[model samples]
Target: METLRNEIQQLKAARTVNVKKDVQALRATHAGMEAKVLKGEKDLNTLRNEVAQSAEKAEKALETGALVLSVLSTPGGQKRKMNEIS
Candidate 1:
């Protein structure tokens, strides 16, 4: 009976150590995943800003094109355009 008790204690201690190691590994993995999530969010924000800037630039280009077309439809503006081209 004494020998059986000692064996049981040793097994319990080994299991405790293994559980602690598993917890540490899980914690490290969670931390790494959190860092990756943060970086992904930052990248998404950067992409959103780029998309907004591109949309603004496209809108400005469309406005400028419309203004040019309106101006070209006028007789005086057409004469000026011809003069500039020459």
Candidate 2:
């Protein structure tokens, strides 16, 4: 009975060591995943800023185009003046 108890204790100790290693590996994996998530969030914010800037530039360009069109469409504007001079 004593020998059996010693064998059981040895098995239990081995299992404990394996569990500890597994826990350490899991913690490492969790840390790596967290880092990746943070980096992804940073990248997303950068892209969003770039998109906002691009949209603002596009809006400005559209406003400039509308102003040009309105000026050209008005009576006695540049187009009518050019036609009269021609």
Candidate 3:
């Protein structure tokens, strides 16, 4: 009976060691993945900013084109009418 108890205790100790190692490994992996995701978010934000800037430039270019067109379409400095049917 004493021998059986000792065997059980040893088995439990081995299992505890294995569980601890597994938990450590999982934590390390989770931390690495977290770092990678943060980096990706930073890159995504940079890309989004670049796209926003490009859109702003495009809007400005279109506004300039409209201004030039209005100047050309006017007569004697009259305000140009919009082509909309409303």
Candidate 4:
């Protein structure tokens, strides 16, 4: 009877160690998933920034083209006479 009790106690201790190892493995898996999510979020933010910058650059180009067209269509363009000497 004493040997049976000792065997039972040893089995319980082994089960406790196994449970702790399983818990640690689960924690590691969770940490890895969290890291992946954070990396994806960072990449998403970078893409957003690139899109915004491209839009701003396009807007500025359009404004510049409009200004040049307005300047060329005005009377000042034809009024310029550099060939006439005083």
Candidate 5:
């Protein structure tokens, strides 16, 4: 019975040590994932800002193109543009 008790105690101690190691590994993994998530959020925000700026620039370009087209549609304006080009 004494031998059996000693064997049980040793097994329990080994199991406890394994559990502690597993906990540490899990915590480290969790921290790494959290950092990745933060970086991903920052990247997403940067992309969104870039897209907005690009859209604004495209809108301005379209407005300018429309104005040029309207100006060219007039007869006097066409002559003026041709003269300027020459």
Candidate 6:
């Protein structure tokens, strides 16, 4: 009976060590995944900012183009009126 008890104790100790190792491995994997998620979020924010800036620039350019077109067409309209009268 004493020998059986000793064997049982050793098995329990070995099992405990294995459980601790598995826990450590899981913690490491969780930390690595968290870092990757944070990096991805940072990258996404940068891309969003760049897209917003690009959109603003395009809007400004379109507004400027429209104004220039309206200015140029005004003179053309006046000429057309004169030509029509002639």
- With a 3 Å backbone cut-off (N, CA, C), the pairs that clash in candidate 5 are none
Each prediction's RMSD to truth? 1.4, 2.9, 6.3, 4.8, 1.1, 5.3
Model 2 TM-score is 0.85
Q: Per-residue lDDT of 1-86 in model 4, one digit per residue for the tens?
A: 99999999999999999999999999999999999999999999999999999999999999999987786687765344332422
For all candidates, what are the clash counts? 0, 0, 0, 0, 0, 0
List runs of model 6 lying over 4 Å from the truth. 77-86
Please give, for residues 1-86, the per-residue lDDT of candidate 1 as tens digits: 99999999999999999999999999999999999999999999999999999999999999999999999988799998999999
Model 6 accuracy (lDDT, Cα): 0.93
Predicted structure with the largest TM-score when compared to the true one: 5
Q: Which stretches of candidate 3 lie over 4 Å from their true place?
A: 75-86
How many Å off is the CA of 3 in candidate 3? 2.0
> lDDT of model 2 at residue 54?
100
Off by over 4 Å in 5: none
lDDT of 6 by residue, 1-86 (tens): 99999999999999999999999999999999999999999999999999999999999999999986776589586676668779
Alpha-carbon error at 17 in model 2, in Å?
A: 0.7
TM-score of each: 0.88, 0.85, 0.74, 0.63, 0.92, 0.78
Error of 4 at 18 (Å): 1.0
The models' CA-based lDDT, in order, is: 0.98, 0.95, 0.89, 0.90, 0.98, 0.93
Q: Please, what are the lDDT tens digits per residue for candidate 2 over residues 1-86? A: 99999999999999999999999999999999999999999999999999999999999999999997887889868867588779
- Name the lDDT value of residue 6 in candidate 6: 100
Error of 2 at 44 (Å): 0.9
lDDT tens digits, residue span 1-86, model 3: 99999999999999999999999999999999999999999999999999999999999999999997887677833333443323
Clashes of 2: 0
